[model samples]
Target: MDKIKLSKEEYENAVDEIRKFFECERDEDIGNLQGQIMMDFILEKIGPSIYNKAIDDMQKYMTEKIDDMYGYMIP
Candidate 1:
């Protein structure tokens, strides 16, 4: 599987959200660099499991839909 890469805008947006979360939840203000590092850590460590789960979810949904297709055929 290819490494997930976020666009520049998306990366910045994620960093901003991270900063906001820390400020709101922890009352600790983090800089942009800190937020980027945190986001990168999250992606490196946690992203794959999330990605795999999404793939699994899609596969299950498609399988169900495909199975239902059998009902559409004229007997």
Candidate 2:
């Protein structure tokens, strides 16, 4: 599948959407609902395949960073 390239502004907007999704006044309230709604909107805009690939890439990057930090700590 071809990668969808986004401008810096577009990428920032997507990040904002994700942040708004999980940021709520109360964690025990309907925050998750709002988050899910935001996620659905984002997924609809980005498409499922791209969304999944982006998420997977982010996870891999984070894991690698953590591993690198762990390696440095052992020295």
- Tens digit of per-residue lDDT, candidate 1, span 1-75: 666789999999999999999999999999999999999998888888999999999999999999899879889
Over 23-59, each residue of candidate 2 has an lDDT whose tens digit, in order, gives 5533433344555566556556767677788899999
What alpha-carbon RMSD in Å does predicted model 1 have with respect to the real structure?
0.9
Which model scores highest in lDDT? 1
TM-score of 2: 0.38
Residue 19, candidate 1: alpha-carbon lDDT: 100
Candidate lDDT (C-alpha), each: 0.94, 0.65
In model 1, the runs with Cα more than 4 Å from the true position are none
Give all TM-scores, in the order shown.
Answer: 0.94, 0.38
Q: What lDDT is obtained when candidate 1 is compared to the true structure?
A: 0.94
Show the lowest summed lDDT stretch of 10 residues, model 1.
1-10
Q: Residue 54 in candidate 1 has what lDDT? A: 99
